[model samples]
Target: MGTEPDIILETRQLSKTFLGFTAVDSVDLKIQRGHIHALIGPNGAGKTTCFNLLTKFLEPSQGQIFFDGREITRDKPAEIARKGIIRSFQISAVFPQLTVLDNVRIALQRATGLSFHFWRSEASLRHLDGRAMELLAEVDLADFASQMTVNLPYGRKRALEIATTLAMEPSLMLLDEPTQGMGHEDVDRVTRLIKQVSAGRTILMVEHNMKVVSSIADRITVLARGAVLAEGDYAAVSNNPAVMEAYMGTTQGELEGIHA
Candidate 1:
């Protein structure tokens, strides 16, 4: 018999209400271990809100979130991260004055909880350089290590963010719009990097790029107006009438952008 899919992340009636506005209505989501799951919806679909709720950036108005069978609905953000969940933002958050190498090194230190050594001499941190470089190389950023993070092109900066997150060795990675703005080449590079890194990890992403979603997603969940509109593989979701109608008035180019 085929082995059952191992679910690493689950949400039961998860929601978030802002004042009188329900940013995210009652929703349920399941992400299998080792799978790349995509959450897609048109604008104002509560995709981002759901992401924030799951990562503990915002508290849910109701419902529960589970990771590895542990209830983390009330866990602090840092506590959730230490439980092996790491989130990558749409805008790569890197220290402008810090060199690319130091950017990754800082992430490595954070992952290892070595932030307490802030007053230590630079030499004392040399041991971390090896692992940092290894992570940089894994994300194709080793050659740019010594350069200031602010000097990187838009795409490389995003790659650097992924490298930093990798330093945490996350079991479940949450990515918000991995390829929002980019040329064809950068998109291709990050896509390949994500696929390569998912060998042993689960990735749940909120993405607007349909091409990237269809190409890499193992399963997909579609949200519309704070609710799940559809759920399935690419072929199944791309053809759903509700999903199609929800994209009402979307230009053909926009539709084509996703169909790819």
Candidate 2:
């Protein structure tokens, strides 16, 4: 007997529309537990729209969303987040004035949903310091805990964002373009960090960088014209003519680079 496929996230007929225009059609996607799933498409492929729908940043026009076998199509963003679905924001999310450790501490505070008005004291926040630093060290920011967030380099700043998100201790992480606008070294660094973090968590990401997706994705879903074009492993999707044709010419030579 074979073990069944463990799906952590499933969407049935999920869709979104803007007036007369359909941004995301009736699409179904499944992400297994402990897998790195990548959603890729051209600029107009509705990839980001699907992500917004999943994250509750934009509600779907019609569909059912199930996270860990629980229906969350009607749940609010905060409610869904509390259920262990957390999305990592872009690099600008960190507190510029606060130190790295302090930034993570605030995230942990927010995750706990503490009644800030009830108990207000630096002493109350003391116990969170060690846990915050542990999260920073998980992302390799242990040495820079005392540095102001704005003083960090662009890549480390992004790492701080990841650390802050980690403070939530999410079971499922949704990352949108985690390595966007990064140079070669930063991209490599963040890629490694992502792999490290995905050890026990399920990751669903909307990414344009084919190289990063190819390197880390356990399964790839290709979207085109607001719908899924292909779904499979990297080897399968990378070789699919439909997927290649979708990115041909419009993706600025990304397909050719993937071939190389």
Candidate 3:
């Protein structure tokens, strides 16, 4: 509910090393509360590594992460999610056999801390069902709520993933390639949905699609070889000589500006 100027996530001298190799090197990142910040780089640029460190999946070799002004460098992944940070994976992570409503209900139950109890009446879960349906509606998947998740098309599966993440009631969402393997239309659909979802929550994503990044990113951060290459609006980074050379394999004069 805060403006984009409010800092929602921060990393201080964050670093991750594997054996003798450094994946992320003393990276400092600041994400605003309600802006859609995009992280882009060539494959193996360590965008995913930075995400893992922020989400607490991987411990930093040195440095710390702060969320909502509280230090969370030592917290576990689930503990971080409990503190209102949720992430969506690149692959479709849904219960294939379960109905869409059931998938969302599971997330709702987790968010609300309601255990599955057969002996007790499910009256408490009725509230969770209402909330789950609300999230499905937000993602425009309410009509498919009773259908098996596997029956939906690939694009809708991604939508269901977003809905499941929304059921968690997160303030900041880290999405890893929301439109990773989609057709043109599907990509556009998910792109619009990402923009829609970013209104009330902070979104930090790693995207390979330059067009998509140029389209929806309010701010862009370019990383190459585990270090910050450029950080600015789309046009600034896209036009920067260093950024173009590092990722586009071109000189600054060869590439045109990325128009939003």
Ranking by lDDT: 1, 2, 3
Tens-place lDDT per residue, model 3, 153-184, is 99999999999888777888899988888998
Give the winner by lDDT: 1 or 2.
1
Give the higher-TM-score candidate: 2 or 3: 2
The TM-score, computed over Cα atoms with residue i paired to residue i, of candidate 2 is: 0.92
Per-residue alpha-carbon lDDT of candidate 1 for residues 115-161, written as tens digits (9 for 90 to 100): 54678688988899999999898888989999998889988988999
User: Superposing all C-alpha atoms, what RMSD in Å does each candidate have to the true structure?
Assistant: 3.2, 3.3, 3.6
Instruction: Give me the runs in candidate 2 sitting further than 4 Å from their true place.
Output: 1-5, 90-92, 115-119, 249-260
The whole-model C-alpha lDDT of candidate 1 against the native structure comes to 0.85
Per-residue error for 49 in candidate 3, Å, reads 0.5
Residue 63 of candidate 1: its Cα lDDT? 94
> Estimated TM-score per prediction?
0.91, 0.92, 0.90
Backbone clash numbers for all candidates listed: 0, 0, 0
